[model samples]
Target: MALSVVDLYRDILPKTNCGDCGFPTCLAFAGMVVSEKHPIDGCPHLAPEVVERCNQELAEQYAAGKWTKRDLAEDALTWAKERSASMNLSDLPGRIGGELLDTDSGKALKLPYFGGHVIISEGDITRADDRELTRWEKVFIYNHLSQGGSRMPIGKWKGFEEFPNTVSKIKTMAGHVEAPLVDRFHGRLAELVDAAKRIGGMEMTGKAHSADAAFFFRPFLRVPVMLLFWDEDPADGFGATAKLLFDETVIEHLDIESIVFLSERLRQLLCDAADEAPQKGNT
Candidate 1:
């Protein structure tokens, strides 16, 4: 007879009860493995051969669980609220092509004009002037901004800086890489670069471009993407700017090739944007 999970644990798992796998005890891990909540690989003691067998068993269990289609009871409003909190607006202004939403006031006001004809003012407001973003462009910005936690924009507005300025940082990060995982990453970077050029209309300097280049190419490549944009006056000319810095662990893994790839891709994007909109002045 095949060994039961309990039987396998009694024979195979180390009795040491280490929390290496985060479970409190070997027996608990064993039980969880059987239920498919914990993988067999979590057991440090099983000989590799035994581990493989356990993995196979767990895979079968996982497949069976999938076929059963588990039902979950959930509160609809809570779900919606949780989902809304993850919502992205990076490209919403460009798509909607009207105004930016003021988070505090719950009102949408026209883009590019701030505090000129207003009374109530506290939080920062962001606006995008470009009116020509494709549907996919909008979604890419929205999803990456909203759903990609911690990477979301800090706030839409600051005292003087607004969305048009903020989007440029999105533009910088967007150029970082063409992920081998998907063709969309390449296409999206192109669209972001173009949209940024068309809308923000900023002619970034060699130094600014170089700094952004370092992020996508070397330091940023190593990090597990934590994109946070905020306004900083690192220097006077770099005014009311968006700066992106990643987690340290990610920077450790970067290689020169990654930097080169990022640089080439970014250059292509910038050149393309230049070709598309020669008239717009640099922001």
Candidate 2:
């Protein structure tokens, strides 16, 4: 197994939020070291020997493909929430293209999620209806805010394989993200399009396009995802495939793990919506 951020926090480096490593907290520093390949020796509290050992171990694991961007869960959420909370929520609306609303509790920003909205305050994020989000969902949103991305989408699209350092995640995106949708909507292209539109995908007319269907989505201000579906043709022996394309600018807004997580969640939402839409085959 790869060296995990949680393990490194628990084992090495004095657990002090000393900010000696140029991060706000030790957890933040550890996450940077493990995930972003920040030098492990940046923590001033670590002895030279300790840094040497960790550097050698991490170097080997990373070279062996054991190190990849982690989900940044649990304590990661803690650090992310703290980091986001320190920002001025009032300024987040312009920064993220979110709508600020005055609620009885205080103020919050309503950001688009799938086809719906999620309200994020300084303390926590909730669905538009005030329901709690899963830890991963919360963490994802917090990390987005922590990234502080503000670039506008350039409109060009690319596949997951186009990004740098995405080799470890290409299979994951295929198996978990694309394959599931392909399996679910194989013979149900009509249903798939309906679900996608219902969940904020704008149907795109295929003009001289080889793809059977295409749709576009702006899951975030800077992060736009395009879906290209090629329905199976039994006569041609072609299997149904769903390929998700991302804006070339997505890397600036989301890390690898978060982008994959976003896709998985989007697939779930699309599948759920398709189930609820009137199914032609159901009758």
Candidate 3:
């Protein structure tokens, strides 16, 4: 195998995204290297021996042919695909909540996605309707298959930031997901609720939670998320706040980065659905 960015991101580089590598994130740095934009040894965190190993691999790869920029794109997905390839296909359904289907080519796992379903077969993964998935959606799917999480949702929810190695992603979550949501639906929580339902979010009503609106979204079969939003109340000098929570078993289902990507997709879907829905004038 060539020394692809996937190898660097998942195996060689420190996943901390510590910024000591000149680029802001490890994925960025890996992409930079794959495009020959930077040296492989740019990351100071890597051991000299590790750097030497990567250099040897890259040298051999370069001798073979050029690596395309597109190849470097979506290192997470590449890593996930590589992981899925190494996994035992038969073991997937037992771990994740999916049905093993017999396709003419090979085995496929039919897993739930939001309310729809996706078929995961070697070299070919698509929605039940066969609609092409976005890059993020592909990452979300492959990450689920790669992890092969066996535990069901624990029925208890906690903030996404509580997960290990997620401290760096907290700001990302707040800025990209939370802030936009609060701005768009602050005093219009009713609209927010409608948007949630549009995206297959189940209203978790009669539940004891601090948020004014609560929804449970099973974005992936074994990976469910609780979206809690505190509507703005100007009378109390409070601003709208939002948080996406996960079951206690989330850490076992997907890595921290995938969890953040999943949330970003949720934000995009919710915002789009809200824009399309008919508005309610007032409560």
Task: Name the top TM-score candidate.
Answer: 3
The best candidate in terms of lDDT: 3
Sequence-dependent TM-score of model 2: 0.69
Better of 1 and 3 by TM-score: 3
Between candidates 2 and 3, the lDDT winner: 3
Q: How well does candidate 3 score on lDDT at residue 98?
A: 80
lDDT of each: 0.38, 0.82, 0.83
**Which lDDT tens digits does candidate 2 get at residues 1-283?**
3568888888996887888789998888888887778999888888889888898889987776565565447656787678677777788777777898898888888998766689887667889877667787777787777677888888778899999999999999999989999999888888887888888888884852468888888777768888888989899999988988888878777788888888888898899999888776521
Estimate TM-scores for all models. Answer: 0.24, 0.69, 0.73
Candidate 3: which pairs clash? none
Instruction: Put the candidates in lDDT order, highest first.
Output: 3, 2, 1
RMSD of each: 17.1, 12.6, 10.8
Error of 1 at 165 (Å): 55
Error of 1 at 281 (Å): 45
Q: Candidate 2: which stretches are off by over 4 Å? A: 1-76, 103-105, 281-283
